[model samples]
Target: MIQQGISPRPEAQIFDADTHLGSNTFSIGPSRTSDGSTFLAVNSHQPWEGAVTWYEAHFHSEQGLDMTGGLFPGSPMILVGHNRNLRWSFTVNHPDLVDTYVLEINPDNPNQYLFNGEWLDLEVRQAPIKVKLLGNLSWTVKQEVLWSVYGPVVRQDHGTYAIRYAGMGLVDIWEQVYRLNKATNFKEWQSAMRQGGFASFNVGYADREGNIYYLYNADLPIRTEGYDWSLYLPGDTSETLWTQYLPFDDLPQVLNPAAGFTQNSNSSPFQTTLDPDNPHPDDYSPTLGIETQMSNRALRALELLGSDESITFEEFILYKYDMTYWADSDVPRMVQMILDAPTPQDADLLDGIEILRDWDYDADPESIGATIAILTLYDLARTSKSFLGSRLVGGEFTSEEVLDSYQRTVESMLEHFGRVDVPWGDINRLIRGNVDLGLGGGPDLLHAVGG
Candidate 1:
C-alpha cells in the first residue's frame, strides 16, 4: 500500500513545544529529606491574587470540604496523602495519546467516506450550543458532530480529519482514583495502575519502608511500525488502526534504580534516572511518539544530583533549591551575547552590562546584579516566547535582540527602583498581610516559584 500524503519528514521527532504545558509545574523524584523523611516534591505554584493555598492539606472525618473524599483542588481526583500507611503524588505523563487520520470522503456522497476499500456512511448529529445574548435572551446554535470509522470526524472545507485518543470513551477515572488511594503496597498500586483508567500521568511514590518508584502511567496504543505516528495518517486502510493498548510492563519506568533517585521534569522518560541507567529510546517503539526533548530543569537535576552516589539529606535540599541556570541553557547563551553586544554609548547600559559581567549567575536575593539580570531574562522570555524550550531547538537569540532587551531592562530598572542596582530580594519580594520577605529563587529554578 502506498502512503498518499504526509509531511516529508513524517517520522521527525515529536516535541513538547507547548511552553504552557509545564509553565507552573515541575515534579522531582523521591529522596530522603533533611528530616530523614522520604519526600517526593512537586513545585505546585499556581498564580493567585486572592487567598493563599497549600498542598500540605489535612482532612479530618468530614464530607466533601469536611467530606471523607475531598477534591484535589480544581481536579476530579481525590486527595491522596498520609493514612497511617503511605503517601503519593502524580505528575503528567505526556505520551502521544492522540492521532489524526485523514479520510477520503466519497465524491459520490459527501456523507460517506472510504475506509478499508469500502465506503462507510458517517454518523452525523447536531449538538446544541446555547449562548446568552442579553437580559433573558439567548441563542441556540446547532453544531454538527460527525463520527467516522476511525473516531470523531472533524469537517473542514478542504478535507476531513478524525481523532483517536486514549481513553476515548472511558469514564472510569473515579474508579482508578479510588483504587489508587486504597492501595497498601506496591502490588496493589501496580494492580490499580494496570487498570488504565486515567489514561496518562506520571506516578511518583514512596512508602515508610523505603520503597521508591516512578511510573510513566500511560495506556499507549500498540501502533504498527513503518508509519509515522506523529503525523496525520491515511485512514482508508485498516493497517493504520490500532486495536490494543501496550501492556503495563512495556511502559518506561524506574523502580528503585541503582542510582538511588528518579526524576521527571516533564522531560523524556529516557532521562528519568541517573546517567547510563535511564531508559534507552531503542527499547521502546518510536511509533509510541514518546518525547525526546528534555526541559531545562531536567538538565539541571542531572547535573546537580547525578554525580552524588549517596546524598545526605542536606545535599538533597540544596540540590532542589539550585537557582543557577544550566551552563548550556539559553539564558546563559543569551546573557553572553548581551554582554558581548556593542554598548549603545549610554551610562545605564554600560553600568548594567558591567554589573551583569562582574557578578555570579545565581538568582540570589541579595545580589544587585541578579535583579537586573533576572528582570531582563523575564523580559526576554515574554518578548520572545519562541525561546522557551531547550537552547538547541528554541532558535538562537540574536545579538541585536539581546542588546535591545538589555537596554529595556536597564531603563525599566532605573524607572521603577530609581537605580539599576536594586537587590533581587527587593524586586522579587513575597508579601503577606504585613510580613514581606525577599525571595531567593527566580523562574525555572529548582525551587521554581513565580507570579
Candidate 2:
C-alpha cells in the first residue's frame, strides 16, 4: 500500500516471485522483468473448498496471467511487475508451524477436559461437509468442531487431540504479502518479516536493490513448563497454552552468506548453500520437524548450482530438466538391488536385468531403463506399510536381487499395459487444457510428481 522508490534497472533484469500463502481448507514461480523494470501487486488467499475458479478469475482479470488450472493444491505461485524501484519475488517459507496435543477428557462430562491438573471447557463449533453420490444428488455431513485452549481438536478412537498451527484462526497474512510486494529495501522487508503471520514454507527473496535473502519462516509456539511439544501433551490446563514464539532472529536463516546462492526443493537445509555454518541441526528445537531428507530434486539442484559460479537462464532451465540420478542416489540403489537377487535367474529375467543394469537413470519417454526402475520402486514404496513409510534399510540388496526386480517390472508391464513396449507417456500424464499431455519426470528425477 506504500511506495518508496522510483528508479529502474537498465540491464536485462530478472524478477522472480513465489507464493505459499493459500489456506489449508482450499488451494494455492520464478520471474524476470521485460519492461526495464516492473512492479506487481501480489495477493493470495485461502480456498476452503473448490476455489480454483476464483483464482482463475482474479489473475485473468487483474494480472492478465494465463493461470487457469495452474493453482493446484500444495503448489503456490507468485506474480511480478513494477511498483517503483522494488522488484520482489516470493517462495514458500518452510518451518514447523503446527503442533498436536492429546487431550484428557473428563469421563463424567466430556465437555470438560483435564490438562496438567485443572479442567477446561472445550470451545465448540459446527462444520458441514458436502458429498455428491449420484447425478445432481448431494448430501451434507455436519461434524462437531471442538477446540481446546491450544487450537482445533481432532477426535479419533485413540482420544481427543488438539492441533495448534500458526495462523490457524488468523486471516491477516495478505497484509504481509502486499507489503513485501511494494518493499524497496532491506529495512522495509525486514520490518514486514517482523510482522510474521506466515505459517510454513521456505521463502526466496530478491529485490531491485541487488539484495537476495532466504527465510525459513514460521510462527513457532513457545510451550509452557513441563510439556513436551513434540508429542501429544496434556491439553486441559492453562499452563499448557503456548502463546509465545521465538523471535525471527532465533529462526534458522541465511542472509548474504559467503555462498552467493541458495536453493531448496523441500530438502535438508544442511545442504542448501555452500556456507560452512549450514544451519546446524542441533540449533533447532526437536519439535520443529525441519525435514532432513535429501530428495532427488534437492540433490539435483545442489549438483547443478554448486558446480557453477555464474548461471544463465538457459542453464537454470536445463538444470530443472535434468532427469539423471546420481550413482549413489536412492533410485540407482533400487535398480541395483533388483539386479543382484540371490535367486536363480532365468533367461527372460536376465534380459530385463541387462536393460536396467545399463540404464542411465534418466526418465525420458524413450528411456525403458528409467521406466522399469521407477515403476518397480513405486510398487515397492506403495506396498510398504510401516509407520515411517517405505524407506530402504541398510545393505538390503545385491546385484542379483536388483536384477530380479527388473524381471518383476517386465512382468508387471506385460500384465498391466498388455505389452512391454508401451511408452512412458502412455502411463504418466500432465492433465491440463483439453488435452492430457504426457509428463517428463519420474520418481527419483529432479522434476517429479507421484513415484
lDDT of 1 at 331: 63
Native-to-model Cα distance after best TM-score fit, residue 103 in candidate 1, in Å: 2.1
Over 205-297, each residue of candidate 1 has an lDDT whose tens digit, in order, gives 666666667777787888988986767788888888887898889788877776666776666788877767677899989878777776666
lDDT of 2 by residue, 1-451 (tens): 1111111222311222222222100000122222222112122233334744233212332442222222434334323222434433333434556665667788998878887677788988889999998999999999999877787887777577787777677666667655555456778867876787566556555446545455667777665544444444445566657677777898777665455555655456666666694788888766555656555555666666667555555565566567677667767777767656654456645656677777887777777676777776665544434211122222234444444445577788878975555556667776656877776666535554442
In model 2, the runs with Cα more than 4 Å from the true position are: 1-95, 123-146, 153-158, 224-228, 236-239, 386-406, 416-427, 430-438, 449-451
Name the weakest run of 10 consecutive residues (lDDT summed) in model 2.
20-29
Q: How does candidate 2 fare on TM-score? A: 0.71
Question: Cα RMSD for candidate 2?
Answer: 12.0
Looking at model 1, report the run of 10 residues with the lowest lDDT sum: 19-28
Instruction: Give Cα distance to truth, residue 419, candidate 1, Å.
Output: 2.9
Give the local distance difference test score of model 2.
0.56
